[model samples]
Target: MPPETPANFWGDMPEEEYYTSQGVKNTQSYFETPNGKLFTQSFLPLNQTVKATVYMTHGYGSDTGWLFQKICINFATWGYAVFAADLLGHGRSDGLRCYLGDMETIAGSSLSFFLHIRNSEPYKTLPAFLFGESMGGATAMLMYFQSPPDAWTGLIFSAPLFVMPENMKPSKVRLFMYGMLFGIADTWAAMPDNKMVGKAIKDPEKLKIIASNPRRYTGKPRVGTMRELARVCQYIQDSFEKVTAPFLTVHGTSDGVTCPTSSKLLYEKAASEDKCLKIYDGMYHSLIQGEPDENANLVLKDMREWIDERVERYGSKNL
Candidate 1:
C-alpha cells in the first residue's frame, strides 16, 4: 500500500474540493491545437489587467485542476493572468493516463498553445513566464531548449528531475546480468527498494490533503513513462549547454525522489548567464506544501522578482 497516512499537500482539500471562484474565476475553457485535437483548461483572469501571464504545464499522471488550483490562485492574486492545462494522458485530455505516446506530441501542443496566447491581442506582448514542477519541470526545460531564443521571459522549476536519485543507480554488471538472463530487462523494473513513493512530503497534514484529491493519484506508471523519462534525462544531460533562458531552480535538501544534487549539477551545467538555485533545508521533494512552506514561498517570490528584473533589463521586445 502507498502509505496510509502521508502529509496533506493541499491542506484540507478532502474530496469535492472543486475549483473555487475566488482563485480560478470560471474562465476555464478548452481550445484546439493545429493537429485538430482539443486539449483542456485555458483559464484567463476575470480581471484581465494583470501585468503578466503565466502558462503552466503539469507533471505526468497529473492534471491541471486541483493540483495547481492553489498555485494558480496565488499567482492570480499576484497580478498574473494564469493559464494551466492538463497534459496528454492526464485529466480530461484525450490520451492514456500515466503513459507516453509521443514526447513531441506533448511538447508541440504546449508550444502551439503558447504561441496562440502570445499572438492574441491583450497578451500579445506581455512578459510571460513558464512555471513547472517535477515532471512538468522536465517538460518545461525540454520546451525551452527546443524553442527559439526569448520564447519565455524566464522559467521557474520546482524540483526538476534531471536525474533520479543516486541510490537508483544499478551496477552496470547487474544490468548486464539482468539483460543476459532476461533477453531484455524491462524498463518498468519496479523500484521496490526505492522509498520515494510516500516519502515525497514529510508533513502529515500536507500528505492528507494531497491524498484526499483523486486527480493527484490516479494510476501507476507505464513502461512508456519510464522510457520517456530516461530519454528526457539523457537529452537534458547532453544538451544542458543549449539552454539560454534565465532559470530559477528550487529543490529540497531532503528530497527523496529527485536528488537535490541533481539540481546542483543542472545549475552548474546550464549555459544561461543568469541562473539561481535555492535548496530548502529539511524540505522533502514537494516544497509547495509540507512544513517549511515559508522557505518555498520565499524562493517563489524571489523567482518572480528575478523574472521582473530580467524583464526590465531584457524587456518584452527581446523576450
Candidate 2:
C-alpha cells in the first residue's frame, strides 16, 4: 500500500525522488563481512568537489533508506560524500530482523565498511566525520573507541541513545526474565508495546511515511537485541569522558525515546575540547526527518554551518 499522503508532508516531492532529481549520485551495494553481507549506500555530489566525507549509521529498527537518506542527500548536495550501512539484522542486511546479538560485531561491521572507503585512494585525504542517530550514536562511539585516536576528523550525533529514557528503561523483572530465557529464546521479541515510532515522530504525515517504510522493522524488540542495547548504552555512558574527537551533538528537548540529558551529560563529561551540544526546544527525537519543514531546516542549517566550518578549516589542508 502506498503511504498516506500526510497533510503535513515536509517536502514538495517525496524525499527520495527529490534527491535523485537534484542530481545527487546515489548508489546502493553490499559490503562483504565475515558474519554476513551488509547493505551499504553512498550519496555523492554530482559535478562538484567533495569537501568532506561522512560515514553515518541509522537508528535502531531503521535503515539507510526512506527518510533517513534525506539527510545523506542534503549532505551530498552540500559537497559531502556520505556513506552509510544498514546494521546487521536491519534493512537489507543479512541477519534476523532487528536482532542485534553482539553489538561489538555489528559496530565492527559498520566501521569496516567506513574504513574501506576512507582508506581508498580517492577519499583517503579527505576530512572524515562519523555520524550516527539514536542507537547508532552509541555504535559510532564504539567505533571511535575501537579505532586509534584522531582516526576521524569529527563526529555528529542526533539524539544518540547514550542513556535510554527512564520510562523506556527495562524493568529489573523483565531483565531477570530475559536472563533466564535468553539462552533458549534469545531471538524472541520481548517488548512489543515499546514501539516509539509514533511518539518519536511529531508529524502525523511523517509518521505515516515512516511506518510505511518497507525495510523498517516493526516487530517487538528481540531479547538479545534489547540486552545488547542496554549493555551498549551503559558502556557509552561510562565511557563518555574518554571521547576526544571533535563532536557536535544535537537533541530535541522533548525527545521521549533517548533522553536529552544524555547529550547534556556527554557535553559536560566528554574530554573533547571542541565538542558542542545543541538542544532544540520542544522538538521530538527525529530531529531532521520527523520535524516540520521549518524546524528540520533549522537543524540542517546548524549542521551545514558546523560542517562547512570544519571543511573550511581542515579540508584545504588535506588537499
lDDT (tens digit, per residue) of candidate 2 on 1-319 = 9546542234356645755686698888999999899999999998998988999999999999878988898999999999999999998999989888899999998899999998787888889999999998999988998886667899999999998777776666876887886476678887645779887999888887888777888888877787788888899989998998889999999897899988999999999888789999999999988988999999999999998888777664253
Quote the positional error of residue 169 for candidate 1 in Å. 6.4
TM-score of 2: 0.93
Candidate 1 positional error at 150, Å: 2.0
Relative to the true structure, candidate 1 has a C-alpha RMSD (angstroms) of 4.7
Task: Give the lDDT of residue 250 in candidate 1.
Answer: 87
lDDT of each: 0.67, 0.87
Query: In lDDT terms, which candidate is top?
Result: 2
TM-score of each: 0.81, 0.93
- Shift of residue 257 alpha carbon in model 2, Å: 0.9
Could you say which candidate leads in TM-score? 2
What residue runs in model 1 are displaced by over 4 Å at the alpha carbon? Answer: 1-24, 34-39, 42-48, 167-197
Superposition error at 87 for model 1 (Å) = 0.9
